[model samples]
Target: MTFSIKDDSPLVSVITPSYNCSAYIKETIDTVLDQSYPNWEMIIVDDHSQDDSVQVIQSYEAMDSRIRLIPLANNVGAARARNIAIKEARGDYIAFLDSDDLWLPTKLDEQVEFMKSGNLAFSFTSYSLIDEQGHSLAIEVKAPQTVDYKHLIGNTTIGCLTVMLDRKQIKHIEMPDIQPEDTALWLSLLRNGYQAHGLPKILSKYRIVSNSTSRNKWKAAYRYWKLLRVQEKLNIVEANFYFTKYAYNAYNKSRGLQPVSIQNGGK
Candidate 1:
């Protein structure tokens, strides 16, 4: 069913956690500014950035009332920064977009309708990967139409940038202060019997930064292992089983197996 967003659409609060992302933050903000859905507030929480990121974001905040900036006193990690923005969110829906990523113009418009049509609490859309230069790598990670806890434990198909959550359904939202915090949050929601439905549209671009912790394979693997053992409390055998599946998916996502049309500037 086709749905058109109206002028009186429910407000969406975009949560953005920023660190030293001055280089790509402007582009990220531009994508949100270009969104077809205008009823949204982008709350950018800067984690004590040493660079000019705070100044850059504050400039936009001054121009638009919907764009807000919260500069932290200390350099908290992304997990904490995100939580701060979450606390300040005053919208019916919540969306996450990292400072380095980009979103399609129709992302929020289409995703809001997708959630409403199914009465979904949590939902995510397909997203493509791009280089730090914002050039599409022709690698896209597709999302299944629906995912439950059983299927999600072995697969990290959801991307933070493409996620949209209905605040009305989820009364309390929080993320553990740990590596792979987004994954932990997803698992928690799914474990509570909340099914995450996906709109299979490439609505966002996840930028692969060279210096990002995700680029370090061993570290990333260790983080996932810890999440499984400590947070999920899975036994050794079960941990290894799920870890293998997660690793396999991560490997495929790194390659061009799920290839899409290559575009410049994350178009």
Candidate 2:
């Protein structure tokens, strides 16, 4: 219950990739500013946005030294942008947030306390989905208590915005250049005998932008299948099995139905 642990060092470093999200990045940054947790720095890497997002980010950076901006010379994808921030992060804990997404006021404080109290290396939380204009979709995805590699392979329940990782535990900290880079990195770690602790608290908000890459359902499914085969090197039968479960969970979330919980252990 006591989130007032010591703040001797920068406890959390937030990594966010910004593109053409000038309209929403302000709100996204504002959420961090409002967090009850004070010992944190935000590392935002702008992926060569054409819009005035750089100006918006700069204004905030000037206001607070904790908010730093890394403007890219050329347009790299989100994976590379996030990797850049990861390389430069100086905090003990690393967290991810997209320019269009948001976090609750106590997100950093509560999650940090949970990880520290339980001695958890990696953790994620449930989140609420919001429409493009910041309207809630009226659905909250509840995270299971814990998810090992097997459960995560079938159910992609860990939102990137809700993740917090211990820097010391992560031997490597770069994300692969894949469609779902966040999931890919999580899988890589989980596969190496690491379990991602899930906090059932809804501490973040994920925005459903109409024009994002995930809008095309069929393409997204195919990309996920490819990720399993190419990244995980899974056989046809194994890929099909996990893909089926992934599809089912995706369907459940799309319809506002909760994804089935993993029991004391996964299936």
Candidate 3:
């Protein structure tokens, strides 16, 4: 069930797109470099951070040949920055991690093994939420049984930092120029008849600081609606369906109900 490759093992490329994430960039790099799996390269794309993010990345790049830093002249956004990194990746499989997240030592190894076992084109893993100080926030997401277009509409269960994809399967596709870029990418792949399975293991740490994107619930809701309109090209009825789900989840989350799981059984 392993992916077919000429070499004994295919290289895994890890992409980290950063912007003003200096506070947590070092931990992110350390997590990747400490992985048990060996065949991997880390590509850090800096979106013209006004902070010391570039300097931090450069320092790491100097220490490890496996690390490469690509700095943009101007600040675009995470979606575009990730697209740039994807274009420059040379490995047979591409994995993504945000600058603020950390991967467990076996993150890559376990994911690669599961992908090989399942012959999956792309996959993600469950993750635990951590604060800026690396303290566990006791937040966890139960992995969905499967990932498909229908399940993705109401919620984005796939953690971007935990996702890995076959480079050959999606070489032509690029990240969409939209907020919540990861969601858009997953939708595109699913719409194109590609299947992405999720590993039930919690192999990554998702940092949930006060200023993190997901904390801005209103903005996330808006972006989710915008993504539905932009990518799915859904009519008003379908768009409202998605919006209502997102709004309800946001409301429930604000009230302290465990984050809604985006399962497919709600049809």
Candidate 4:
């Protein structure tokens, strides 16, 4: 399939927020450099990392003009760093890749084709899990065929590293300064009459770092409930309903079992 259907290929700006990820940052950058799609720029925003992460990223900047680094003066956070990169992004399409994530060679090409052909404004793909040492765990999380605001309230399966958004379709893209900013952003878009379609292809690898935010399931679930009530303004009844469903899916995910599938719709 053709990657860019249009005559003028739209540039895809890959936004990555880095924070003391020196060990895996180089591998992440190499994954982007090896993508089959050519029209892309990788913008790495360092969130005041104390390690050699900045030095490692700087070493790659001289090699390719498409790779650019934005060092923050203060250590804000991942949400703020990603927001800064999004605001400065020059590409028509915005793709997100975390500092430790790895993308397959055809990730961009196939996803771009999928979005263009379906006329989708937002899209996300399934991804496999990897250990800290970059060894595949063979555990893949599949995204639902489609998700709306309410659909996502229960199951937040869209991985940040596997998502791509069309800037022309959604304006004023800013992730909320919350624990799970990516999910909040997707929920905001879906609530604003946008639908996030899922590409079933496993096109990315999510590195499960030890002591990561996601590893803390209890805290994450609490934050998810808070987001539903505070950010989405769901009432007590509505919040309780979705929070229960969210907890169930979280349990399944923790056990390496499939979360509530779209077919089941959390039934």
Candidate with the greatest TM-score versus the true structure = 2
lDDT of candidates 1 onward, in order: 0.88, 0.89, 0.82, 0.88
lDDT of 4 by residue, 141-250 (tens): 88889888767888868899999999988878899987689999999898889999999989999998888887787888778988887898888878888888888886
TM-score of 4: 0.93
Clashes of each: 0, 0, 0, 0
Ranking by lDDT: 2, 1, 4, 3
lDDT of 3 at 102: 95
lDDT of 1 by residue, 1-267 (tens): 123557669899999999999999999999999898888999999999999999999988987888999999998899999999999999899999999999999999899989888889999999999998988899888888888776777776889999999999999888897789999999889988799998998999999999999899999999999998888888888888788877877787788454222121100
> What residue pairs are clashing in model 1?
none
Off by over 4 Å in 4: 1-7, 261-267
Where is the poorest 10-residue window by lDDT in model 3?
Answer: 258-267
The residue-level lDDT of candidate 4 at 28 comes to: 99
What candidate 1 gets wrong by more than 4 Å, as runs, is 1-7, 258-267
Name the weakest run of 10 consecutive residues (lDDT summed) in model 2.
1-10
The global Cα lDDT (0 to 1) of model 1 is 0.88
